[model samples]
Target chain A: MSLVFDMALVAGLIALALHVVVTRDGRGAILAFMAFGLLLGIGWARLASVDVALTEAAIGGGLTGMLLLRAQAHLVRHAAHPAALPTDRRRWLVPALSCGLVTLALAAVVLAFPRPAPSLAHQAVASLEATGLGNPVTAVLLAYRAIDTLLEKIVLILALVGVWSLSRDAAWGGASQLRPAIIPEPLVFLARVMPPFGVLIAVYQVWVGADLPGGTFQAGTILAAMALLVMLAGLRLAPQTQSRALRLMLAGGPALFVLVGFLGVAVAQGFLSYPEAIAKPLIVGIEAALTLSIAGTLALLVAGPPDRAPEP
Target chain B: MSAIALTSASLFGLCGAALVGIGLFCILTHPDLLRRIIGFNILGAGIFLVFGAVARRGAAMGLSGDPVPQAMVITGIVVAFAATALAIALLRRLASLTGSATLEAATPPRSET
Candidate 1:
């Protein structure tokens, strides 16, 4: 019975994906892509990766859909012509054949996966106690492979910089207008009602993440979404790019992570190696800072490049 | 993993494979930059699903999946979102500057002989 349900889910996922690729209207494609993300989240749950499922739903579906929908709206307003649909018969055949072949090859590999698959689960579980974290995924992220997590944070910051650099000279250091000029009453009502609960859930996710499936990425994204909602409803203004407090919030998590990592060299076995006695507290400290930084950075990224001139 | 679980894993894995193919087709054939960006995201989702399947098959020691890959996927999802935002920002800027939403349409037209 469970297998049947899983099969149906996968079928739905594939159908949505096909629709996303084949849809003529750009807006319809994006809507299908959002649904695809949500169904993909369910697929992750069926695979038993709840942490990934949460990330998929929040960042993958919610935040990314928002960004794409906003971009689509912007493009519609700026471009005189709508995107042209591919109508040439000669263009279709080769791509279809090649893609089908690639799918077949991958499916063959999946069927032939090695038995008694090699894994790091035992090693991760064994050393998980050293980090003093209840969640093995958290231990792996913050302890076993701290450098990747740190670098990923840097990538987020760098992407934000790249986005900001696209702004025109006059708009540098200015605020990006994220909300549409005309706002609907129901959206404003929901935005007003939703954020307090969103904040509570975001904090809860981060706080429980040390022992559960929730973590900085998932929680941070939730916070980012709430901030976006508030901005969209015109409850608060999107920050100017040069705002001192916003810059600090964006850099705080990564700065703290790097500082703690270097401290490990002086106090522990090596860089990012937590001393057994104080490991849990240290990891939690890093997560707390990271959650804030990630929230600020992600919200700003979705807000896009600065558009309004500076208020000086 | 049990037989049922193994079957389910492969089913999702195959779904992922088909998605990658579909996304690649869109990226290669679609003229619009925004559509291509969406295609890139679909390709990414497919890759993550494949990773999830690997994690599932590696489940042992009472864990549902391998923590390492699951952790990696979590990180990958965040990074992918950042990349998508950057791409969309770039596309929006291009549209504003060039007055065209697609590369093919952006070029100057040739005069008939």
Candidate 2:
């Protein structure tokens, strides 16, 4: 019976996704896409990653939905109606063959995972006491592979810069008709109640990240969602002529990450080796900074241009 | 079989694959910028489902759902959001600059004919 039900849900999810792809109208497709995100969140929760589920729901569904909707609205007013979707035969065949190959490759790899391994990940977990962090993943991300995490953050910043630079020159005069409907009354009420809860949950996740399956990235994503919701309600933030605060927020994560890594070098005589004496407290501080930075980056991404809209 | 575990794992795997297939089709066929963004998001959702499956595997092993993979998935989710937002921003700019909402029709590269 459980298997039957599981299969049904999975099939439903797949059908919905296929509908989104096949749908010709861009607006309808986006709505279906948001529904797909929500379903995926439930799927994550089923897998025992409540932390990931929350992040997926908030960031994956809520924020992405809002941004796409806004862009759609903006385009509708400033540009000609989109042409009919392409129907090239080669396009269909290429994706079908490529997806098939990718799926088969993935299945082959997953099936090959050994039941018994040399257990390097386990060894890393067992030796977590030396890393000064309570969460094994945090220990891995910051202490073991600090360079990778640092570079990832830099990639994020660079992505934002690239997008901003590309879009800045396009003159999009305000189309009064382009504004999305005002935040609905029920949605407004829900929004008010939700942010505080989101804040509480985000804080709890960050604090327990040292020992549990929670962390700054998940918490920060939630926090960013709360802010994104408030901004999307049509309350515009004033644009800063100078991006001093933006610079600060963008630098916050990598700066804290580098500072902590250097501190490790100074005290432990090795790169990224946090001092055993004060690992927990220091890790907490770094996580806090990370949360702040993540929230900032996500908010700016949602806001798009400093010229179009500002985060109030 | 733990009822909850048995049900959720299979459901996630099936749903994830479906999403991936549809998303791929949309991405390849759709010329509208908005539709492409939607497709990109669907693809991300499918990947999230895969992560969920791995987490369920951790549970069946009698350990708490492994935090490492979960953490990485969460990171990926946030990054995906940023990427989607950036893509939408670019799409809007493209729309405005070319005054065409469909991407394939938006710009025609110059030729030395």
Candidate 3:
């Protein structure tokens, strides 16, 4: 019975992905892509990775959908006419055959996967207790592979820089107005009411993440979503791109992580190697800073480059 | 692992394979930058799903899946989002400046309408 349900779910995922690819209109494709992300989240849950499922739902489906929709609206005036584009039959043949071959090769590899798959689960679990993290995933992220997490934070910052650099010279150091000019009453009402609860949940997710599936990424995404909602409803505006506080918030997490990592060289085994005595608190400290930075970076990423001149 | 679980993993894996194919086709054939970006995301999702299946197969020591890969997937999702945002921002800027979103080769040097 469970297998049947899983099969159906996989079928639904495939159908949605196909729809996303084949849809004629860009807007339609984006909507389908969002649905595809949600289904992919469910697929992750079925595979028993709840942490990934949360990230998929929040960042993959939710934030990405918003970004794409904003882009769609922006491009509506300049968008190419799909009907006017030439669609020759011969243009499809090579791509279709090559894609088919790639799919078949991948499917073959999947079916032929080793019977006793090699894994790091045992190694991860064995060393997990030393890190004082209940969640093995957390241990792997913050303890075993701290460098990856640190670098990922840098990637977010770089992406934000890339986005801000796109702004015109006059708009530099200005506010990114994410909200539409017109606001509806119900949205304003929800924005005012939802954030308090969202804040609580975001904190809870980060706090429990040391021992559970929740973590900095999921928690930060929730916080970003709440901020976006408030901005969309005109309750607040995105911070100016060049605000010192905003820049500090964006850099604090990674800077702190790197500082602690270098400290490990003198205090522990190597860089990022937390001393056993203070491991838990140290990891938690890093996560706290990371959550704030991630929230700020994500919100600003979606807000795009500043569009308006700074208020004189 | 249970036979049922194995079967489900394989099924999902195949589904991911198909998604990768469709996304690849879309990326190759579509001229519109937005569609290509969407296709790139689909391609990424497919790759993550395949990795998820690998993690599931590695479930042992009383864990549901390999925590390392799961952690990696979470990180991958964030990075992918950042890349998508950058791409879209670049696309928007390109459209604003060039007044065109399609990236087809300008053989005839078509003028912006």
Q: Write the per-residue lDDT of candidate 1 for residues B75-104, one digit (tens) a residue.
A: 999999999999999999988998778877
Mark the 10 consecutive residues where model 1 chain A has the least summed lDDT: A79-88
The digit string of per-residue lDDT tens for model 3 on A1-312 reads 978898888888888877876666678888888988898899899999999999999988899999999998888876544322235678888898999999999988888888788789999999988999999988988999999999999999999999999999999999998888789999999999999999999999999999999989999999999999999998988788778888999999999999999999999999999999999999999999999999999999999999999775
Number of clashes recorded per candidate: 0, 2, 0
What is the per-residue lDDT of model 2 for residues B9-105, given as tens digits with 9 covering 90 to 100?
5457545655666676667777676787777777777776765666555542234465556656766776677678777778777777888777463
DockQ of each: 0.57, 0.39, 0.58
lDDT of 1 by residue, A1-312 (tens): 988999888888888888877776788889998998998998999999999999999988899999999998989899645444466678778888999999889877877788887789999999988888989988888889999999999999999999999999999999999777899999899999999999999899988899998989999999999999999999898988898888998999999999999999999988888889999999999999999999999999999999999786
Q: Is the docking of candidate 2 incorrect, acceptable, medium or high quality?
A: acceptable
Which of candidates 1 and 2 reaches a greater DockQ?
A: 1
Q: What is the TM-score of chain B alone in each candidate?
A: 0.86, 0.79, 0.86
lDDT (10s digit) by residue, model 2, range A1-46: 7567666557667777777767656688678767867776666666
Q: Which regions of candidate 3 deviate over 4 angstroms? A: A82-86, B1-6, B105-113
How would the docking of model 3 be graded? medium
Clashing pairs in 2: A134-A210, A135-A210
